[model samples]
Target: MNINSIKIATVTAGYVAGVWVLCSIAVVIAPDTLRYISGAMMHLDLSQWDWEMGMDTFVVGLLAWSFFSWVTVWCIVTLYQYSLRSFS
Candidate 1:
């Protein structure tokens, strides 16, 4: 089956944006929990690190991450389509 790269990328980007919004809210509501989770993921101590989120940083991060996710998914889908055509 062929996949629509644009649609799939948009959906993936939307999903990532939603997660980013939730994470931003989580950071405001439960920063310590986020810090702990981040620390665990990184396998390092982040308790003493300063957690700062400015409006500019948040907006930039949201845009950057969403765009990055969209591009990544688009590329993957395009590659998959190419591989399917190549193999069959």
Candidate 2:
């Protein structure tokens, strides 16, 4: 089945933004849980990461991630469509 590139990119951007927002909230509510989850799954050490959370940072992060996610998914979808066109 063929996929709509823009639709997929939009959905992925929303998903990424949602996840980042949740992570930001988790950072505020229960830092330890966030740290544990990141450590176990992503092998990231939250403590070592130097980041200050604030309104500006949150906005910047959300926009940055959303844009990045959109671009990444758009590229993937474009490549996939191109391959299908070449093969079929």
What TM-score do all the candidates reach, one by one?
0.96, 0.82
Residue-pair clashes per prediction, in order, are 0, 0
Residue clash pairs of candidate 2: none
- How displaced is residue 64 in candidate 2, in Å? 0.8
lDDT of 2 at 21: 95
Per-residue lDDT of 62 in model 2: 99
lDDT, candidate 1, 5-67, per-residue tens: 999999999999999988988998999999999999999999999778778878988999999
Give the TM-score (vs. native) of candidate 2.
Answer: 0.82
**Deviation of model 2 at 12, angstroms:** 0.6
Q: Residue 12 of model 2: what lDDT?
A: 96
